[model samples]
Target: MATTGESTDTAARTGEQYLAGLSVGEREIWLKGEKVTSPLDSPELRSAALSMARVFDLQHEHADEMLAPSPDDGRLVNVTHLIPRSREDLERRRRAIELTAALSGGMMGRTPDYLNVTFACFSGRSDVWARRGNEEGAANIVAYQKLMRDGDLSTTHALMNPQVDRTKPEAEQMMGEVSLHKVGENDDSIILRGARMLATLAPFADDLLVYPGSDIRPQDGRYALAFAIPIATPGLRFICRDSFSKQRNTFDYPLSSRFDEMDCVVIFDDVEVPRERLFLDGDTVGYSEVITDTGWRGHIMHQAFTRAYVKLAFAFGLGHMIAEVTAVNRFDHVQEKIGQIWNMMELTRAAIVAAEAGSFEDAGGVWYPDERPFVALRGEMPKWIPRANELLQLIGGGGFMATPSKADIEGPLGPEIEKYFQSAGADATRRIRLFRLAWDYLGSDLGGRGELYERFYLSDSYRMTALAYTIADKAFPASLVEQFLED
Candidate 1:
C-alpha cells in the first residue's frame, strides 16, 4: 500500500527503490564463466535480491505494526533492525525469520540486522578488557547500535572456521581457513588480512559482523576481535561463489529460477577497520564471552528452530496438495501419511514451545534457551526429519518423482502430460501442476536445495536425534549416575 520514493532519502528504500539504490559495482558478479554486472538481471541472483528487498518493503508498508522503536535514535526500525531487548523480544525476532523463510520456502533469503542485534547485546554486556581510560569496546557498541539505527542497515556474519587440519594449533589451522588475524595498532583503527570460512551475502550488506567462535586463551588476543565495516570499505572484496541456481532451464523450474540467498566467501584483503567500528579487538576473553554468551546461542537457536518449523509447514502443505490431486485422501495409507506429516510438524513446534517455555537466562532484553535443551534439539533433527520425508515418499509412491516438468506442461507435450499425469478426477494437466508443485519440494533441485538449506543449519543431519540429550544439562546428581553405573 505504501510507496517508496525512488529518489527520496528516508529510513529505507522500497523493494524497487532499494534495488535501485545499490551501487552497480556492489552487484557486479563473476559466476562460472560469465561476467554478470547486474545480479538483478541474472536469474540466479534475482530471487535473492527480490527476497531481501521485500524486507525493506515491509518496513515501509507495515511500519506501524511490525517495526520496532530504535532506542539509540527513537526512530522506527524494521524487524531486522530492531534490537532484541527481552526474551519475548527474541521470540518475536525468531518469528519474523520464520515468516520470511515461509515466504521464500526456507531458501535462506536473509533479513538484515540479524547478526547486528546479537552483537549489539554483546557490546552492552561484554567488557573483559581495557585499552584507553574508556573501555573503547563498550563505547563502540553504543556507537554501532546508533549507526545501525541511523543507517537502517542490514549485516551478514561469518563465524565458523573452515575445516582444516585439526591436529594443528588453531593459530595455524584457522589461518587460511577463515577470517584470520591481520595487522594494526590500538590506534584509530585496525587492518585485517586473510578471509572468512563461509560468507553469506556480505557483498550486499550495509556492514559486516566479523567475530571468532572458537574458545580463546588470553594469548590468542589477536584472533579475539569483533568489528563492523561498510561493504564498500577499501580492500574489502567479497569474492562470491557460483550461484547454486545453475540450472539452464529458466522457463520450467520456478524455484531454481531464483535462489533466495546468495551466500559468498567475503575476501578481506588488507581491509582497514576504523577504531569506532571495532567492538572487540585484541581482547580474547571479551570476544569468547560475546559468542558463548547465552545471547548469541539463544538468537541462533530460536532462528534455527523457527526456520525448521516453517519448513515443515511448507513441506506438509505440498504433501496435502499432492494427496488431493491424486484423490488418495480416501486411502487409509494416505491418511496415515498425512498423520505422519502432522507428527513432523509437531516435532518442530514442540521444540519451539519447549525453548520459550523453558527459557533459562535473560540478558540485554533477550531470553536464551537452556544450553542443554537447545543443544539437544540442535543435534536431534537430522535423523528424524529425513525419516518423516521418507514416509511421505512411501505414501506418494512414485508420484513425487513421476511428475512432469513444467516445460512439458506448457509445450506440445503439454497435452500428453495433462492426459496422463492427471490423477483421479484431475487430468494430467491438473495432476502435473500438483506434481510440479511437489517436485519443487521433493523431486527437483529445489527440493534438494531445501534439504541442503536445512542440512546446513543442524549440527549433523546424518546423526541421531537422541544425541541432544548429551550436550544439555547443567548439573547431574551423582547418586543417579552411581545407581545406573552400579546396576
Candidate 2:
C-alpha cells in the first residue's frame, strides 16, 4: 500500500480532505424543508457523504490501480480522468472502475469517477466544441478537465429538465418557464434561471454540471446550454427528495444507511456562469452533437456498464447467499430462480469484456469502448434488475419480514431468538442479520430508487432500445439475405 501522502507526488485528496471540503458550507442543500448547514452533522446525509469520502480515500490507498499521471503535468490523477489512447489504458481504467464499483457493491452510481470519466471525454474531444463559433467552449472544456483532475473534485450533474408535462412542448407548458434555460448574459457571464432534476449526489459534490438532458429543438435554442459551476454558487439550490438514509443502523438498514446517494431538483435563480466555465451556449445543433461526436457517449457508458455489471453480480451473490442460508439451494425451482440472476450477471460481464476487446480510436485519436455492447446492456438492465429483485424476494419470501430487529436479537429475547431463528447453515443472529440486509436492499426506499435509477439513468430504456435499432448497420445483414435469395 502507498503511504498516506505518497499515492503520487501530488497526492489525491484523502477522505479527511474530502469531508473538510464539504464543511466550508456555502452550498444550499435543502432536505426535509431545512437547509443543511453542515452535511457531516446531518444524520440523513452524513453516511452517504462519508461513503464518498471513503472512495476518495480508496483512490489514495489503491493508487497503483486508480491513479495515473496527468497528460499536462506530473500530478497524479484518477484513471477515470486519464485520456485513454490505447486498449491497455482502457483496461487499466476498467480495473479502477471495478475497484470503485465493488466498494459499494455498485450501489453508488454517481461516484465521482462517473464525472471524472465524463470530463476526460470532454477533454479528449475538445475539438468537437470548437466548431460553429465556439472555440472558447473547447478551450474551457480542456481547462476545466485539468482543474477538476488536479483538485480530485467530486462532481454531480443535473441533466434532465423537470418532467412537468410531456404532452405540451416545453415552451408551451405552464411550468416550462421554470425549466433550466438561458435567460440573459452579461459580458463576463451567461445568466440562467429555472430548474433541473435528478441531480444525484448534489449535496456532497464540490461542483454541479448542467448540460442538455435531451434533444434541443431549433426553436428551443434558448434552452441549449452546458456549464459547470460550484454547487455553492449564489442563487443555486438543491431541493432533495426525502432521504432513504434516515435509518442509521448499519445492521438493520445496511444498504440504505451507507449508500443512499440523495437525488434533488436543482433550482437556479438567475445563476451566472462565467464565460470560462460555459462549455456550450445557446447552440442547439452543437449541443445535440456533444455526447455522440465528442466520445462522451462511449466513455460514460463504459463506466456506467462496468457499474451495472458489478451491481448485477452483487445481486446474484446476494441471491445465492439467501438460498444457501435457507437451504433452498436444494430445490429445483429455487435453483432455477438463482440461475436467472446468474444469466443476467454473466451477460453484463460478457458485454464489458466484449466492449473493451473491440475498443477503437475515434477520429480525434481518443480510444473508446465499442459502445454497441453497452447500448444493449443499458436497455436490458431495467428489465433484468427488477426481475433480480423479484427473485431475491421470492427466495427470501416472508423471511424478510419475519426477521427480528437488531434490538430484539440483543435484548431479553436473545435466548428465545437464538433457539428459534437458527437455520441449517447459520446461527440465529447470523440468519437475522442476513434477512435484515436483504430487506434493506430489496424492500426499502433506497431499493425502489435503485430500480428507478437503472430504468432511467441513461434516459428512458425504451428510447435507448429504439435508438440502438435506428442507428444499427442493417445493410450487411440485408445484403446477406438478398444474396441467399438470389442463389
Candidate 3:
C-alpha cells in the first residue's frame, strides 16, 4: 500500500512501476494442462502485460489529458478514477478512456481504466451502500478506490457465474457451477468456495473483483456476493483457456502476439474474504443495487463503446490498406463494402458524441453518460463487428489464405515468393505483411476469438436489444404515443 506524496512530482505510475508490481506476484495461473510458474516467463502472457504497461506509459506521456489531480491527495492520478461532479469532469474521463482505447487499437477490452472508473462510480455514490446499512462497505469502497488510484493497480473482474443449468435456480446449480459462495462467516472474514468464469485478462491483472451478474435472483442471496481479492490470494486458482499467442511468430499473429489478454476460470477453494474486501454479502437487493443504483452500467458501457469504436476503426483502416495494396480500391463493389465499414465506424463514433451530449448528473451529483446511446450501440455492435470482419475477409479473398509465412520469405524460396507473391505496387514482403495483418484480424484463430469476444462481450444481442427497447419505452412512454394515435 504505497501512498503518493502530496508533491507535484508524485503522479501516476510509470510503465516500469506497473510491470514491477505484476512481475513479483505469486499467482496460480494454469495454461494448457500445466501450471505457469511465472506469468512474465510466458511469452503470450508477458506480451499482454507489456501491452498494458504501454497504456500506463501513455498516461505519463499525456499527463494533462489522462491524469488529473486527486481531491484526497493533491497528487495527480489517472483521470478514470476521478469522481465526476460536473459534465466537464465526465468529458475529461471520456477523453482518457478514448485515448486508452486508441492506444490499444480498441483490442484490449479490460484496460485498467474501465474498472478504475467502475470503482469511482461506487465511491461517487457511497450513500447507496450506506442505505443498505453497510457503512463499512461504503468506507471500504472509498479506501479501495484511493488505494487503486495511488498504487495504480490493474484489475480484471469475474461477474458471470459459470454456465450450468440456467433454467435451474442459482441455489440449485451444481456445487462449483455457481461461483464463489458464502460457506461460513467468522468475526473478521467470510469463507467462500466455488468458481467464476470469463475472468478476462486475469493473468495480467494485479487483483480480481467478483460481482453478481445481471441474472441474480432474489432467492440467490447466498450466491449474491461482491468482493475483491489479490490475484495471488491463497486457494484462488486461474485455469486459462488456450493462449492464441503461444509460439506464433509476431509477424504471423500480430494482434494475438501482443494483445492476447488471456481469459480464465477462477476457482476459489475456501478462499477467505476479509470483511473490508466485501462490498455486499448475502443481500440480493444490495447485490443488484450495487450495479443498478450505482450508475455503473452507463459509465462502464461508455468505456466499452469507446473501445469498440476504436476497434472498428482499426478494422476499417486495415481494410483500406488491403484495398490499396491489392489495387481494388477502384472497383465499385469493393468501394461499396469499404463505404459500409466506414458508415459503421462513423455511427459508432456518433453514438459516443451523442451520449456525452446527453450526459446528466444523477441524484448523487455524479455525471453519467446517457444510457440510450449505449443501449443502441450495444444492441448493434454484435452484428456490426462480425460484419466488419466478414467484409475484410470477403475483400481480402485468397490473399489472406495464401500469404507466405515469415519464415518462407527469409528462407531459400525467397526469390520464388518475391517473384509470384508481389502485388500491384507492393513487393512480396510488404504485400505479405499487410495480408498477414489482415489475416490476424479476419482469418486467424485470434481473429475468430475477437469475433466471439465482440459478439458476447457485452452480452447477448437479444438482451441488449430488449434493454434498448426498455430505455426507449421510458424515454417515449406509451401514453405520449396514445395522444398521436387518438388525434
Candidate 4:
C-alpha cells in the first residue's frame, strides 16, 4: 500500500491493473456465512469484479471522453478526478459519467467514479476539512485525493450509522458503541470501534471512506469522525447480504449476474486510523459542514443524476420493446404506461441540464452544479425508478410469467417454445430474450434491491423534502402572490 505522501505512475490504470491490485492485500469479506478469501475467488463476487474491470476497460477504449490531463503532471487520469474550473470542464466530466453509467444501464450505482468525484470536491475545498485548527487533516485530504487519482483506485464509502434504535440518537442508545465512534487515541493515531451500514461495493473496492452520516450534536463529539483507509486493514471486516447473482448464465440473470455490486455492513473492531489518513476528528460543527462546506452534494449529484437519467432511459426502451413485441402498443393504456417512463427520463435530463446551466464556482474556486434542482429532484427521484418498474410489470402482464428459462428453451421443450412463444413483432428467441431481460430488471431480487437503494440512497425522501422546504428561498415568490392579493 502507498503511504500518505507516496507517488505512483501517473497514467490512468487499465482493467488488468485494477484486478491485480485486489490480490496485493487481504480483505476480510464475509458472505453467506463464510469468509471470502478474495473477490476473484468467490463466484458471487467475481462477476461484479469483472464487470467493474470492464468499466475501466471502457474508459480506456473511449479515452477521449473519459480521461483528462492531470493538473499537477500532464499525465492522463480519469475525468472524475478532474477538478472543474468552468462549465466546459463540468460537461467533460458529465460525458465520462454518462458513458460509464450507460455501460451497466445504470445498474451498478457505486462505480469507482462516484467517490472519485467526491474526493475531487473534498480536495478542491481542502480548507473546509481544516476547520477547528485541523490543518494537518486538511493536507491529508489533498494528498489522499492525489494518491487515489494517480493510482486510479476504487473506493467505497460507508456513511450511515447502524440502525440499532431509530427512536434515539446514537449517543443515547442503550449501547454506547453501537455506531462507529472513537474509543481512544495514541500518539500517532485514533482507535475506533463499532460499525457503519450499507457500504455498497465494499468487497471489491481498494479502500473504504468513512465519514459522518448524520448531524452530530456537540455533546456527541466522540461519534463524529471521518477518514480513509484500506479495506484490508487489520480488525476491519465487511458482512454482505445474500448474493443476488445466483445464476451465472447471462440469458437467465442478465442484470444480477453482472451488476449486483453488493452492499455490506462495515465493521471496524478496534481499528487504528493513522493521523495522516484522518480528515475529520471530534469537531461536531465541522463534521456537520463537510458535505455542504466542500460542495460535495452538488458535485456528486452530477454523477448520480446522470446515472439516473440513463436508468430511466433504459426503462423507457424496455417498456417500449415489451409493448412492441407483444402488440400491446396499439392500446391506449400501454401507450400511457410507456409515456410515463419517457416523462421520467425527460424530467431527469432537464434537471441535469438546468443544474449544469446554473453551475457556479464556489469560494474555494471549485465549480459545482446548482443544487436547487438536485434537491428538488431528490424528493421526486425516490419514486421514479420504482414507478417505472411497476409500469413495466403492467406492460408485460402475463408474458413475464410465461417466459421460458434458457435451459427449458434449449431442452425437450424447444419445439414447444418456438411454436407457442412467437409474438407479433419478434420470433420466439428474440421475444424470450427481450422479456427475460425485462423480468430480470423488474421482478428479480436485484431489481428489488435497486428500487430500495434508490429510495434511501440519498437518505429519507420525506426528510429531504422537509429540508428542501426549510432551506428554500421563498420570499420573492410569496411576495409576488401577496402583491396580487393586495391589488
TM-score of every candidate: 0.83, 0.97, 0.95, 0.97
lDDT: the better of candidates 1 and 3: 3
User: Which tens-of-lDDT digit does each residue in 1-487 have in candidate 4?
Assistant: 1233444334788889889988877899999899985899998999999998998898889988888678787677898998899998888898999999998899889999999999999999988988889899899999999999989999999998888898888888766677889999999999999988889999889999987667878988888898999989999999999999855588877888899999999998999999999998899999989966889888888889999999999999999998999899999989999999999999999999999999988999998899899888888889889999999999999888887888998999899999999999999988998988988887889989999999999898899899899879999989988998984
**Which ranges in model 2 have alpha carbons more than 4 Å from their true place?**
1-8, 484-487
**Local accuracy by lDDT, each model:** 0.62, 0.86, 0.84, 0.89
Relative to the unseen true structure, what is the C-alpha lDDT of residue 217 in candidate 1, on a scale of 0 to 100? 66
lDDT of 3 by residue, 248-277 (tens): 677877787888888999898899999998
lDDT by residue for model 1 (1-487), tens = 1334322234545677667645434543446666455556776776667667876686666554446655544455555545455557656666667665666665553556456456555644544323333377677776777677556666777765555765554477745335367666656778887666666766456667776666766776667777887766667655566565645453445566555466666667778888888777776666666665536665566666676677677667767777877778788888888777777778778877777777744644444554454566566555445555676676677776676666667888877776677677577766655666556555555566456555554346444244444444535566667777873
Candidate 2 global TM-score: 0.97
Per-residue alpha-carbon lDDT of candidate 2 for residues 1-487, written as tens digits (9 for 90 to 100): 3345453466478899989999775888898889986678788899999999899899888888988776665677788887899999889998999899998898899999899888888888888888899999989989998889888898999987777887766676674696788889899999999888679999889999877667767788878888899988999999989989955578788889899889999999999999999999889899888966888878888898889889888888888888899899999999999999999989988988898899999998899899888888777888888898999999998888878888888899999999999998899888888888877777889988998888888888799889889878899989988987883
lDDT pick, better of 1 and 2: 2
Q: Looking at model 4, which ten-residue stretch has the lowest summed lDDT?
A: 1-10
Off by over 4 Å in 4: 1-10, 484-487
- Where model 3 places Cα greater than 4 Å from the true spot, the runs are 1-6, 175-178, 474-481, 484-487
Q: Estimate the lDDT of model 1.
A: 0.62
What is candidate 4's CA lDDT for residue 452? Answer: 93
Deviation in Å, model 3, residue 159 alpha carbon:
0.5
Error of 1 at 186 (Å): 7.6
